[model samples]
Target: MITRFEELDWQDTPIGELTLRRRTEPAVGQEIYEVRLGDEYLMSSLFTVAEEELSTLGLAAATGDDLSVLVGGLGLGYTAVTALHDDRVTSLTVVDRLGAVIGWHQRLLLPVSAELVEDPRTSLVEDDFFALVRAAPAEGEGDYSAILLDVDHSPRHQLDPTHADLYTVDGLRSLDRHLATGGVFALWSDDPPDEDFLETMRAVFDGVVAHVIDFANAVTGGTSSNTVYVARSRTAGEPASDRPSKAGS
Candidate 1:
């Protein structure tokens, strides 16, 4: 049986500080927050289908036993928790730009995120994801097997305007430099990415594909779809592209 759920006043929660209004409910015994800023639905703490898709696709493309990964965002620790499920993953570094978000996980969401955060395989960092990727070792220069990014809504729709750089040709090229040989870069988006972004991935990596996931709200039974972009590093003997194209030009 489902327990009776309570909605905390939006003015009393951390989610309220980051978003305009917040409402929470229980789904399968887990708490899910539905936050809205103006008319836009930000994100939630439960039923993370895109995060699962990123983890599943990232692990499938990984090579070797001691696989290292970099997660670009730490939303509710869903992706991090999912990544920790694989025993082959030796190290996982999660980067988040907001300290308050991290603090929320520690104080309020610890019961849900504690296992992954305390696990020996996890390391959390507070920084901009773009800076982390840019400062990482050069392409074919590190041990990272996968770089999973969920920084923005999608290439076509961004939560923040600055995130548009992440889908640009230059941005993809910079991201390509941090990947180990045969390593994969997986990105989660709220909608299917535009063709330009797909072509940008093709220009930088040897293999590129898109995976679609349909998410159903456990409480409301409403459905929504998201996409994951998977790109593998060029093999030793393969040639990589260096050309830059205008976005959707």
Candidate 2:
């Protein structure tokens, strides 16, 4: 059999060594793309159900005709590209801390890269998403209609320690400032539903819901799940009663 694995690109980043690899699975006889940061796997093309759902569920909560969306992570470009599928999205800003990640899309290193970069509404920005949220625009001055994040593994688990603050009540409050009055915020987590984090989100946002997305895991021949938290920014004069906590699957 011919060689099935190839390392497309590798770079040393501030956090660790970033590498992109492509391999053909013998069982399925299909090509799969994967990204790794040092020894930890960042993302894989083999599974992207929750990532797409992040855009779907987030935008579903947003009420507007023309939507300006911001995506926190650019892994494999699934989340960003999924948002682009919605014609209502007038603009999309994808922020990634690693420049190399953005470079991958620009170079069309992955399958979804062309679709994400070809769109005029798409803008790939290299910056710290957490920092941007912390220094969000003044209330009501914020322009984005929806903000979706999938940077870390989960709220309790983070790729970097600095990201821990963003999961807290105060950090979420700052994030609330970045959205328009009726804008929505969504996050993807590798872990199961986190009631504690949901409570923290409810403190700042109105109508907080945690959605558990289940998908088929080919490797394990079993079902795996990820959590997507959807919440709307509290508008001025909005009653406290409007905040409702719920979970979905």
Give each model's whole-structure lDDT: 0.72, 0.91
lDDT of 2 by residue, 1-249 (tens): 353889999999999999999999665568999899989888889899999999999998889789999999998999999999988999999999999999999999999999999999999999999998899585554668999999999999999999999999999888888888878999999999998998888888888889999999887889999999999887888764453677777
Q: How many pairs collide in each candidate, listed in order?
A: 1, 0
Model 2 Cα shift for residue 134 (angstroms):
0.8
Model 2 bad stretches (over 4 Å)? 1-3, 138-141
What TM-score does each of the candidates earn?
0.80, 0.96
**Whole-structure CA lDDT of model 2:** 0.91
Every candidate's CA RMSD: 5.2, 1.7
What is candidate 2's TM-score against the reference? 0.96
